[model samples]
Target: MARPIWTGVLSFGLVSIPVGLYTATSAHTLRFHQLQRGTSDRIRNRRVNERTGEEVELDDIVKGFDAGDAYVLVEPDELDEIAPGRSKALEINGFVDLDAIDPIFFDRTYYLGPKSKDYAKVYALLERALAKSNRAGVATFVMRGREYLVALKSEEGILTLHTLHWADEIRDPREEVPDLPGSRVSAGAKEMRMAEQLIDTLAMDWDPEEFHDTYRDKVADLIKAKQAGETVEKAEPAAEATNVIDLTEALRASVERARAKGKQSKGKQSKGEQSKGEERKQRTGEQSRQGKGGKQGRTGRRQGRKESGLSELTKAELYERASAAGIPGRSGMKRDELIKALEQAGRQAA
Candidate 1:
């Protein structure tokens, strides 16, 4: 089981509920580490003094403020004293309507659950009350020695806390965007009606699971293929941007494309749902007929191999094939290291 990173009491009105905070999301992207090119040695960073051309130790480092043209160095302990909080507690100052809070303020989200069995009832009560009132508890908390504005809302019968950005952090759009001089109004009622129709036809319920990071998937596939000792080919350059002249014609074409895409998506979704249902029925039927004996033992392995086979093969394939020949974590290796590893593995196999 995943453990909560933080343990604290959530304060609102006269009530305080002890809760544990768990991260609600995580990144799944591949990471790379720096290394020396020729020796396959991991590279290490150093804090260096620019003037002396020498590495500085951690203890020598101090917080500095620019006073005119001079740097005023402050001790670590002194710096900590001036920081937002020595004690980390979410001090909720006021309650606000969830809708009233601007979407721009939200930063990161955390799941807040009862820290102990005793707090469960109060937690549930707070969640239900927030749900019924359509209000979120506004709170202040200190994290990493800094004060943060947080919104506490009920999500699926559990309290979820979201860290908010300060008002000053949000940039004013008006500053960057120019005010239009009321000259670009050429769409007639018929065009407006057609646009609205197109929008309505393409609209669907928001399903987050339906969307994915396509770029991340492609990167993963590329990385995997490169690991397996394959030569990576250069991708085609992107199409150049073109200037549009006829707005009406463009709008018409866009509407047709949107409709076509919507229909295709709907058809795919229906087919997928049907396939899942059929699979479930087949599993049930097999269970009834052969008492678990009909189940395939290597189905998962076979499926994995099939998926790996069909995925795009890249230069990463060489690294992976090298790794299989006793190279470790070729995924973290550089292109040159991968090439060397692949060559060594090939020679050994020969």
Candidate 2:
């Protein structure tokens, strides 16, 4: 029942379908407002001229582009004059295999629906053709004053448009990631086998519904406790294992723990549930769940690689992890201190 955000024509060669675009995703994060401490006075943001130090009116404000040592002022109408593809057309560039595109290139998704009943047949034909051919229509269009590269694919008898990242937006991981560009660390065969065993033992069905935001729930509890005039005691810090040094020993220990966890999880599953991941085998034909296990395994491997190298993380990322782990006095901690604290927190949680 969501209203369309854009009405346009989807064009390819001689075929055109009158269609509308609607956002397909939404955020559920709780919103907060800035306020003065101990009072309900809301904090408001103001745009002021830096030289005069006075609030500026909307009519007096103009967009400026940085030109080396100076700024070039531009009017709103001047932008439209240069924006070529804003002519209410979703012009198709070409069709490509849907799997050929990297997942990282996708930014946002929007549902493409027929704007009028007259174009329903055209829409259906395009959708069916894409679905049967297992392809996506690549296109470029303008929306909200910005040009976007998109892929239109058929999903469940409807067309879905996925906006993509421009080629220059993606950064080289070697430039940003630590030890990735020139890493020399190597692992023994025994250690690698043990790690694989650990992974295989821990593999299980994923039910998103089983997970909840524990920190958010705790935040809500804190608010309620404060309103009731109750003083809350700080949670005791957990003890962590720190003496282990051998890689093989660590991998062996992890494998044993994972096996134990899998055994424990067996009691949590219902009698009708499938072993390993057979439970997901009966999903609807409209969407295939066959390759999910492979995808999840790769994801787990990537996460494993990341967690095994905490020293590779930047100070800011370590600090964020510490905050999420509820490390007290983290704001006062140095970079090394945050990394050590996070390592201890991670061990305690494990």
lDDT of each residue in 158-209, candidate 1, tens digit only: 8899999998999887686787445675657766777787788778777443
| Alpha-carbon shift of residue 31 in model 2 (angstroms) | 1.4
State the displacement of the C-alpha of residue 305, model 2, in Å, after optimal TM-score superposition: 45
Which regions of candidate 2 deviate over 4 angstroms? 84-87, 181-183, 231-244, 270-350
**lDDT for model 2, on a 0 to 1 scale?**
0.74
TM-score of every model versus the real structure = 0.69, 0.70
Give the Cα lDDT of each candidate: 0.69, 0.74
Each candidate structure's count of clashing pairs: 15, 0
